[model samples]
Target: MDQFLHDHPITPRTDAEKQGVVNRLKRIEGQVRGIQKMVEEDRYCVDILVQISAINAALKKVGFQVAERHVKHCVSHAVKSGEGEASIDELMEVLKRLSK
Candidate 1:
């Protein structure tokens, strides 16, 4: 077992990538606030549901982007270093949660 495998690993991301994720999350935050306002204003139920759906989809997209990065960097590194099983297991666990 690699010593690094048991320890937490840090994945370095570029400033652009960080900013992109931040931008996406900010938009989602705004969407959520809009939904709250819609509720306060007594907007149509179906319209509010539609906006909620959009926010859910947006959040899933952001999650997938992060997962892709995790697989490319963390999983690949673990595999190359002969510590793939644990990393893959961790990834699969999170994937299961994401699917739900």
Candidate 2:
């Protein structure tokens, strides 16, 4: 896992791919700010909880997109290079945490 941290993606994301993720992240950031404002305004608890849930779902969606790309590119490259086991194990460990 430590080694994986130092490694770069075998196939780097294209500008479009990066922009898409960045766009989604920016939206999520806005949503977070909105939540902060809601708190300041003393919004209803249920309303705040709903927004929090939406944010969680949005984050999970982004996470899955990233994981899918990682598996398709990085894991595939590692398998071809005879480093599949370690790469897979590392991915699985993180995935387990993600699910939790």
Candidate 3:
């Protein structure tokens, strides 16, 4: 909840794409708020942990989506502009980390 938006604008997304991201974020926000309530109610440790796992999975799903867009757009643009090798290498490195 303490997140600060950067002055730089996000690359403008399509209505559908933006909505998709927004929906995912909203769901994540609700999950976080639910976790807060769980803590307040002193929920069982395993129950909290299950929620934590679900949140983590949701976050990673979002990460994969963003990563897919980066590869399809940003990296493709770079490759088309003749920076292909560097971009591909960079992308591979990122994919390796993400897959871990």
Candidate 4:
């Protein structure tokens, strides 16, 4: 097995926060399964496309939530600790990728 290193958040999420994100992800998972079923049933192309668009929007919403929290907690902490430039740069790079 390969192990990958990951950074931890400066401020850990509360159980409620974790659960909220998890619930949204679970709903998205269900939506994905629904799309697969639709495909198996030969659903209309436009309807499937619409669901895909919806999934994209839902994913973006989740991403924005995580980004907002990162800015509020991580970036803010780094700024307070005099490491804002690197943090901001890292954030901007990821933001550019997200935009793409």
Clashing pairs in 1: none
lDDT of 3 by residue, 1-100 (tens): 0121122122456889989999998999999999999999999989999999999899899989988887777667667767768767877988898778
- What is the lDDT of every predicted structure here? 0.90, 0.91, 0.79, 0.88
**All candidates' TM-scores?**
0.90, 0.93, 0.78, 0.92
Rank the models by lDDT, top first: 2, 1, 4, 3
* C-alpha positional error of residue 27 in candidate 2 after TM-score superposition, expressed in Å: 0.4
- Highest TM-score scorer: 2
Ranking by TM-score: 2, 4, 1, 3
Ten contiguous residues minimizing lDDT sum, candidate 4: 1-10
Our tally of clashes for model 3 stands at 0
C-alpha positional error of residue 86 in candidate 2 after TM-score superposition, expressed in Å:
0.2
Superposed on all Cα atoms, model 3 deviates from the true structure by an RMSD in Å of 6.3
* Model 3 C-alpha lDDT versus the unseen true structure: 0.79
lDDT of 2 by residue, 1-100 (tens): 3365347777888999999999999999999999999999999999999999999999999999999999999888888888889989989999999999
Clashes of each: 0, 0, 0, 0
Q: How much is 5 displaced in model 1, in angstroms?
A: 7.2
Worst lDDT run of 10 residues, candidate 2, spans 1-10
The superposed Cα distance between candidate 1 and the true structure at residue 85, in angstroms, equals 0.1
Top lDDT hit: 2
